[model samples]
Target: MFLKRITIQNFRGIQEMELNLAQPSGNRKQTLIIGENGTGKTNLLRAVALVMGGSDALAELLNTPDDWISFGAPFCQLSATLLTQAGEERSIQLTINRGDTLKGIVLANQDQLAEIDAALAHATQNYFVVGYGSLRRLNRSTGFSRGGETIFRQARATNVATLFNQEALLNPLNTWAMEVDYRTNGKGLDIIRQSLNDFLPAVKFHSIDKEKGHLIFLYGSTQVPLHLLSDGYQNMIGWLGDLLYRISSAFNDYQSPLKAHGLLLIDEIDLHLHPKWQRKVLDYIRHKLPNLQLIATTHSPLLAQQAQEHELYALKRTSRGKIALEAFRGTPDRLLLHQLLLSPIFDLETDESLAVEELKKQYESLKRRKDPPQGKLHYLATQIEQLPQNQRSNMNYGNDQLDLLREIKSELKARRDS
Candidate 1:
């Protein structure tokens, strides 16, 4: 199943917005949302979880119903178009009123409601939808008891609990690693290992030490437990590792559980990830699980650079002070860091200091005068030379960078033609 599109209104900081997540091309399922802090990125993700998970989602993410809807607004409405496994697209909508109780969600369309209700009821088959918040941490490996559980329970357990509820995290990977390795004859651990090692540069998950009560990894020349690694390793390992266990459990019979197709809602996809590793996160996961539709938010420009035009959406506050989801056009993969930040998506007016801007104005103003002051003009020019934009333009990357530059230009030209 896939979330084809979404319409969120009166929800948190968003007044009204719509995003077409999946297109008919099917290959354009991966979507990346970018916005400044407090632009409602997290709220948007929570809205989707509420729609997908319904009241259970509301309970998991929120406590105050009145505050759930945008302050001063009457209520919050969430609408979504889901592409089911049978290739049918169904539109479902629900709302949360200011005074109304947030017990169970009641849909506006009974026919569509019945379809979604049935799918949600089964929770094990037909379609799969999971939500993940950005709080990923592996503090310890003890206290988790061994047992078998369905994917539905596991997904919800990892969704927002990591950020909101610390008690919910009780050695998720350690709890299930031994059982999965035992059942699959080490094949399960192999999938987890390869997946982790492929994305990470130096760290590798070799195996889980049953005696240590935590998963072990090969970091550089030495080995270490999950908790012993740095926060970045633990964050990625805990998050992706838990996701694998959940999805794999759903498709335990398959040779590779990543083959299971579904919609994955993850907030702050770049959380706690290094720049090098973060740059390729989307591409790596998408390459392995092509059919899985990923809807995520981030502030990372490197991650946004990897997204196709159709897959990129920016949330910005309008002139009237309302938040809107704007689609960024053109081939962004070839844009430089500064250029990307100054694009229509980011709308960064200028990264230079006010002093530099004043210098630019003075230079322009002096040049316009009939008898311009050459001394002041020369001083302004020197300061302008120090500006980042000017420095980039005058950069000399040495002979070794020429080939890479040429290749990038050629690729950019080809993308522009398409």
Candidate 2:
């Protein structure tokens, strides 16, 4: 199933916002929302979880403050339109009023909706809706325990250890192997190994510490614990690993890597990621879970730019307190920093650095003067030369800065000669 659209009203920093996440025909299955801090990116993701998860979603919303009912607004409203795998359309809506509990409804064809509901209900049974917030939980593996009770709990995107253990793997693989004529355990290991290598080649899963409680990763010859890794490494590992476990747990279809179709809501998907990682994260997710509908927010332009125009949504809040989705046209990656800085997505008025902004102002000032003063012209040239070559190169707009500086110098010489 995939989400078609989501409408949010009076929620957190957003007064009203509507996002059409469905890809244009023939486009890929990824929707990326980008905005400055506090533009209700996180709120939008949380709203999706609540609407899709139903009763289980309520427990998570309890952490929201009472004042969550936007100031001067009576309540908050969140509605999502979903397209089921069977081509049926349904809409789920939730409302939260001040001094009252949140209410929700699903509107669709009864039979079609029931099937969709059953899938979601089965997801809840397997703890399937993966919510990965900014601060991901990290822990050392406490190894295997025979006779341990399997915790059938709603799975957070950060916690998938329960499903990664021997018990979880052995039980499912052995059962599948017995039913079929194939060795499922070996195949499962191969899938896990290949997935990890694809996502993070430097780190492979080390032998499980049955004697000691620790899950280790192989970095050369040394075994490293999850907590010991850098935050970026840990974050990616935590989310991607959990996602694999979820897919395996929810569906027995091993022929396809990820068989269960579920909603993946990630707040700040680029959090703690390097630029390299940011560029590849979405592609990796898409490759692994081909059918999973992904809704994610990111501040990284690298990540946002990589997505096709139809897959990216820019959330901009107007001065009057209304949030709207800005249209992203043309190929995003083709736009340089100067263009991106001015794009509606970033909404940058000037160069990111103060020195560059000053240089731009000086250039404009010199351009405006009918007969520019020698001192001002010389100063502008000197400032441009003083800036690093790469910095000046990046700051170039329609005209190259070095060429402009030379042109201004030639003009100064001609004026003196006259």
- The window of 10 residues in a row where model 1 has the poorest summed lDDT is 145-154
Give the per-residue lDDT digits (tens) of candidate 2, residues 235-290: 67766655554455456555454556767777788877888888888888788777
Model 2 residue 31 CA deviation (Å) reads: 0.6
TM-score of model 1 (CA atoms)? 0.79
lDDT by residue (1-418, candidate 1, tens digit) is: 7787789989888898998776556646788999988898878877776676544444545556677788889988888888777788877777777876545434333343455667766865345665566665443536454122221244443444443343444235665566566677777777666656787778878788867666787888798876778777667756665666666666564257667787777788988888998888988878877777888998888889888768888998888999988888876777777677777788765555678667767766786799977677656666565555433662433343345334434544565598
Off by over 4 Å in 2: 26-28, 63-66, 102-128, 144-187, 204-209, 213-228, 251-257, 333-339, 349-352, 360-377, 386-407, 411-418
Best by lDDT: 1
Count of backbone clashes, every candidate in sequence: 0, 0
- For model 1, the local distance difference test gives 0.68
